[model samples]
Target: MIVDRQGRRFRNLRISLTSACNYACTYCVPDGKRLVAAQDELSADAMIQAVAYLIEAAGIERLRITGGEPLVSPKLEALLRGVSQLGLDDISLTSNGQLLTRKLPLLLETGIRRLNISLDTLDPEAFRRIARGGDLFSVLEGLDQARAAGLKIKLNMVPLRGQNLDQVLPLLDYCLERGFELRFIELMRMGHLARAGQNFQQQFVGLPELLALIGERYEYAQADAPVDATALRYKIAGRGYFGVIANESVPFCRSCSRLRLSSTGWLHGCLSSSNRHYVGDLLDKPRHQALPALQGLLVKALGDKQELAFAGGTTIMKIIGG
Candidate 1:
């Protein structure tokens, strides 16, 4: 199996197919900004081939498809089918859930068994305002479709101060009632808004406090893993189970077994670090040569993995697939 320098096993791979997104979330793409042009992006075929190479070389067991909005990628179902054919043990996708209502069945048909949908607010107006142009009803419909498809669905909530924090209890209530997993992710220090004036401390909320509040009705089950995961999973006092992911105010740099493949074909060794290795350039190289080079780079980066320097820093969720 391929192992990076920090002894972090390379088992999970997150690949971003495209950087283009339909909605301009206030915290993500923001209001007015030009996104990456489509002309310079990798085609579907190239992405599949690259994934195949990585799997063959590193023995990667799980793959996650992410993007500005993975569903928006033209013929995304076809692309997922290609990845499914690779025989990876787990194949998942993280989407904004806007287009999922219409494509849920098709995605399931393509062998997508897991989904993590981003939904920050329960209010229609708040959803529209934060997500820019998203309709809360559409996202809810998509959630229903996912449940109907029997896929393991997780709700990804980004809690921003003065934004969606007040909805936490409501989200938990929804999850407990619906038997869905609720993951409250703290905003990371990478994004158009974060760079502008988003205060990390003000927006930051610790996992312990969040879990304590939920403790009123739930009992947490901590994982044995070493990674600093924010998702404090728990059973809702014989009712149901859910989780929370805290990225800020608490960092999980060590034991980070995940690697990110950007839309541009760069492999990010660590989420907090800007260091990356280009895999696209080696696409044409012989497998014998390319595999070792890729492995070597990963190993080196793993060794270099450092703890997050600050509560907030670079590395947006979109860039690496939140």
Candidate 2:
């Protein structure tokens, strides 16, 4: 395993099952249409092959199934079933929750214990505005269904300054009441936001500002988090916990033990860096031929990690697993 100078190694892997998504989230894409799968997306068998190889080559222990949206991917079941049989220490999924209810049985059967659902607000109008094509009612219903199924839920909210800024308190309150941890992800400088500095500045909500808003209603204290955990967590006494994935203001780059795999077979060591290792061809080769080459690519991926802060980049979050 390649550990950076900061003493971080790849134990966690995020796989983008497909580049395709059903919702045109404003923060994800500029327009209303959903992101389409890449023309040269790898097959489900190919992706599973890569994951099997990475488990041996990179010493990956945990897997987070992501996507443009994993639920919409035709290969989701195959990927999930294949990876589950690999004996990973942990396996989770992150989605927009649009199809959670419909996919609940599949998830439960495949052993998905926890998940992160991206929801910006509780208000119907604002929800529709933020996620152009998704129905808020359906999303909420899915969340409820997942919860009832005994799946631990975390709600991921990216607070935009002028848009869902007021959603901070309400969303947190909603999560607390329903036993879900609300993770406030500070707006990342990616995709279209990377090119438009002014627009990003206008919309970006830092961690401090977010805490101030939540502090107005909840009395919380700093809480312990796993060393490589992305979110800096907090607890509000009798209520449940909430977290902040403050990539900008309180960057967790030093202890970021994550590697991302795009559906097209690129391995990204750091979200802030553009370096990617293509192993699509390797996935097709015999194990003996692939492992030696894939191990070298793992080293190059970890070599791209920054020692401290995350300097934002222009990679579309929708293209890679966000």
Against the reference, the lDDT scores of all candidates come to 0.73, 0.90
In the range 1-322, model 1's lDDT, one tens digit per residue, is 7654545677788898788777777667654442453566667777787888888777677898998788887848667878888989889999989999888878878888888888888999888778877689989888887887788888888777787777888988887777687888766666544465536567666777677777675565654432534355566556666666666545566566677788878787666666778888777778888788877766665654565432333665566566
Off-target runs (Cα >4 Å) in candidate 1 are 4-6, 30-37, 193-198, 216-230, 307-312
Name the 10 consecutive residues with the lowest summed lDDT in model 1: 223-232
Candidate 2, 85: how far from true, in Å?
0.2
Clashes of each: 11, 0
Encode model 2's per-residue lDDT on 237-316: one tens digit a residue. 99999999999898888888898999999999988888899999897788899999998998889998888888877788
Clashing pairs in 2: none
CA shift of 270, model 2, Å: 1.0
TM-score of model 1 vs. true structure: 0.89
